[model samples]
Target: MTKYFRSNVDAMASYIPGEQPQHGTQIVKLNSNENPYPPSPAALAVLKNIDGEWLRRYPEPFGGEFRQAASKVLGVPSDWIVVGNGSDELLGLIVRACVEPGKKVVYPMPTYVLYRTLAEMQAAEIVEIPYSEDYSLPLEELVAVDGSVTFIASPNSPSGHLVTTNELRKLASQLSGVLVIDEAYIDFTEENALVLVEEYENVIIIRTLSKGYSLAGLRLGFGVANPKLLQGLFKVKDSYNIDAIACAIGTAAITDQVYKNACVAKIKASRNQLATDLKQLGFHVWDSQTNFLLVHPPQKKAEYLYQKLKEGGILIRYFKQPGLDDKLRISVGTDEQNQTLVKALSSLL
Candidate 1:
């Protein structure tokens, strides 16, 4: 594999995503944090009404339509946005633009593991600081590294905790390099770091429609920052990164905020109820600000339960790594789906 590739490419492991079992009515998927609800009617309408001829031509180079729609929703100017195939692609773009071989990329762990994979792809040195006891931002520790870029996934995955806005602002002020705030799950949380964009020129906030808007298949995500900071991204991004279909559907979906909000409200309610049920079963569940719960099962049966659930046509995330080997991440599913998961776990107990 490495004979024709860079030495670093041969040494890195690819990022493993949650499983998507395509053919099973019996399967209740709670592994990936996908919106259990459907996409906005307005977006579906756009998908239905797209003129075939429009796609025959090249798409607008920078996702003009989506930028304007998200701008209106976010109350920011359109130029301040940079759209990506997914927030994942935008994350890669930032890494490519900022990190050189042997440069440092920092974040608190355990986090979105993609950051580590992205750094490995670039042969960049990675600095992973442990989260504070309460999962607050390790501000002083992060600032000391002075890395080329820092990535913070708010309402962090597998932990479901968010860094305080004030702490992020302070870190942004203290850092000598870029601060990328990954807000993929922010819709489920009470607060966010969007305001930091206007406050600090060095900050970039990444978001996705995959979680709250129910548009994961569309692969649409965007980054928010001061326009000055977006120049390098523009220079490195593919000429036609966003397609006409995504632009149209994304515009309709983002513009239909009422529909998106209703769905988010349901997921949040379910998250609360699910946490309560798991606690009753003796699992140590974290207070989540996202559409999932990070639970440590009683009797150290986390791994065993994960296997038994899968055999019962249920799927949840199980990480076999240090610090998280004993935990499971359960995505908030519909009430019926969650009941199936709980029953399976209970039967194993």
Candidate 2:
């Protein structure tokens, strides 16, 4: 570690993102919860029509065009929306804006690991409330934590379960600090907590195009909250956080709700089939509301299956963390890719 690095920076372990192999290699990628479908045709059209001259100028600092489109779809006013390079960036922004050094940032254990890393970067105290044995949200425990910022990943990653809306509203009402509902995969779920933004000034809901819109490569995400909370986030955000092309393409993607919904429908169907196949193979599959499954295999260890699958040209996620060691997070992929995964697993077992 460098001598000049901040003590917190030196001590913190950076977040590990999903692996991305080199271009052109053959692999069935189910590690990252990325949409297997193509982005909306309207988004592609926007990219095709990008004027080279526009690249010479800076993008709208606050991503007005994208926010306007998101506003129309989400039914929130434009001022209540703030676009980021991705929801990850927005997560960091929330920590920086709401958490002071030594303040607390609370989240459920076994949720997205990035929340801990972000809090660590800010030198904030992390309060992790463990989920119930069934992996349901521990609403009472979370509400008791004296945190400056609380993160709840609805339809949480690694375990595709969602916290009930009533439970979330109760927690939000009881919390003393900012409540951030990270709804990255909520598109696949039946309901969302966006309505809480209008009901509670402290509630902020973040969403991304990565999973639902098939725009992971574009790095587009946004957060909606009361105008007051958004004003604070704006202060901490990068001056030109979003690029011009991303704004144009994101606007196109959000405007084409039909295309986005079509892709989501396909993924949801595939998720069900994948879970059923795994269950049939004697694996324990958690009921998922997102485009992925948290599966516990029948015989071999999760790490072993992960390695064997990789050798067989399929990739899935296996977290080395304590509670997740026995499970694998398999992203819902195209029909062909999913079949390849099932065939590979059948042979390994």
Candidate 3:
């Protein structure tokens, strides 16, 4: 019975999300990088309106309305958009499409962590290019990986440092592979790589409604790339990846630019204040262009701090991986939530 599983399945290394503890009412959850705010009024309205028909009929296989909404909002054509349950689904699809048995997939170390896990699931050779001490994208070294597929998370995860346009352009020009850019945190940043897809056929950018639009639980995301690349993906995707209720909520969220901008602005402000305060407390707080911060804690060890925070009804993420062993990733919560986290940290330190 133990030998029945495929070798790839048995050896598979899974992606670990931050803890979701349900025991406390006053808990401040700064883990999982989720938008601390709830979904927009428009999204809530759509959710409220849903009923029997939505539950009865199958949704459009391609997330047609969501695509159209994203197209109008992103200023890209609908043909360039492909919606998924979350950007994770789109990532898994890309892995299935581009990775053949022996082909390789390369991404920076200390990245989203899922890229390596997804590559392994495809049985693709995994190439890990370490980031610099400053956590910048090592494009010069990354391009050297002998792989046909390269996945990069812009304003990358855990550390939230974005790759510059110049660095990305250099990779596009030099690499012959499909360069998949995960922009899950792009809303918090001033720069984006969406325009690059027009100039480079190989650039695929994945986005989510989770962070920017505040619809994580709805599971709405899209991958934008050239039509040719999306066509290849269509063959491997599940028929109705986007459900009816999600499609409705996602469309409303993407179209409501005013609401989205306000939320992003608030989160950015919170992130900056948190970073400054953490630095003042003698922690090496990384400057983030996203909604979270990767901080080196003061006084107590990371594991100890994590436990103390947990006891105080606050949850932040701690990674057991090498290089990140001493760091904790904290998401920007609401104003009061942010204040509570700082206070808890202060008392503990």
Candidate 4:
């Protein structure tokens, strides 16, 4: 007889995180869309002051300081915010809270990948709506699907395209179910879906401290939504989702707007320069509002470029997905590291 596992667990497909290669000290890692810079001095100062009791006691169940700071930063109320281990944890909780076995869950295909994985884990039927060639959401087709929840990312992963507010509002206004705007990369863009949360009771916006704050190691993220939506999610999450140190560092990061803004400015400038340089080298670069650029290399397959770079102690993302086989998603590294990658590519191509 088969072991007594949940039917969903038996068939669920897991999300594959980007490769974390550990070999050379000289590796210029641009594979995962991680911030190229280290966390601001403010975050480091908080970590430096950690006391003995900090590790002994369990973190506050509500993460009051973190919530209040995050709320103020986002211009949302603290009561409507719920912090998690990472946005990935929040995503999973959202799925479990809204979706039931056999219900439908919709998301754009070739998105974050976790959306489909989470839906399947919950035993929900997956409806992956394809994006247009420009990677814009097919808003009309999305609304036509019958699903308990829809997940969409602004400044989408791998593609680095932003979904416009008009189309997003159209879906939020018309859809009967929840609309989740995964804005993990929203810091890289000039616009966000957060403003729509006030108008649509069903809209939930997820944000992270990973990219802009350079705190991926902190594993801090939060959800902004109507109190009712948060209420549903609160029922599913672990009692104390965030740790004390992470909460402290996250709060500090949010409060230090000057430092965060400066870092973002540098990253945006570097991203633009890198994009232009890649295009000049005969690669087709996608317009990006995020920390990474997706480019079609001038010569050799994307896999070949990826492998060659890895061997040369440089790393960038390359996908084997059906439509994305020709592209590589390169996170903006330090100027020197990026130049190193370019030089290596020049030699190979």
Q: Indicate which candidate wins on lDDT.
A: 1
lDDT of 4 by residue, 172-290 (tens): 99899999999999888898888899999999999999998999878999899999889989898999888999999899998998888888898899998898888888999999999
Q: Against the hidden reference, what TM-scores do the models get? A: 0.98, 0.98, 0.97, 0.97
For candidate 2, the TM-score is 0.98
Better of 1 and 4 by TM-score: 1
lDDT of each: 0.93, 0.91, 0.88, 0.88
Sort the predicted structures by TM-score, highest score first: 2, 1, 3, 4
- Where model 1 places Cα greater than 4 Å from the true spot, the runs are 23-25
lDDT for each residue of candidate 2 in 53-124, tens digit (9 for 90 to 100): 769998889999988899899888999998999999999899999999999999998999999999999899
How many clashing residue pairs, candidate 2? Answer: 0
For every candidate in turn, the CA RMSD to the true structure comes to 1.1, 1.0, 1.3, 1.5
Residue 321's lDDT within candidate 2 is 86
lDDT of 3 by residue, 136-217 (tens): 7787787888478898889899888999877888898888889998999999999998889999999999999889888877
State how far residue 329 of model 1 sits from its true place (Å). Answer: 0.2
Least accurate 10 contiguous residues by lDDT in model 1: 1-10
**Backbone collision tally, model 1:** 0
**Candidate 4 Cα errors over 4 Å, as ranges:** 1-4
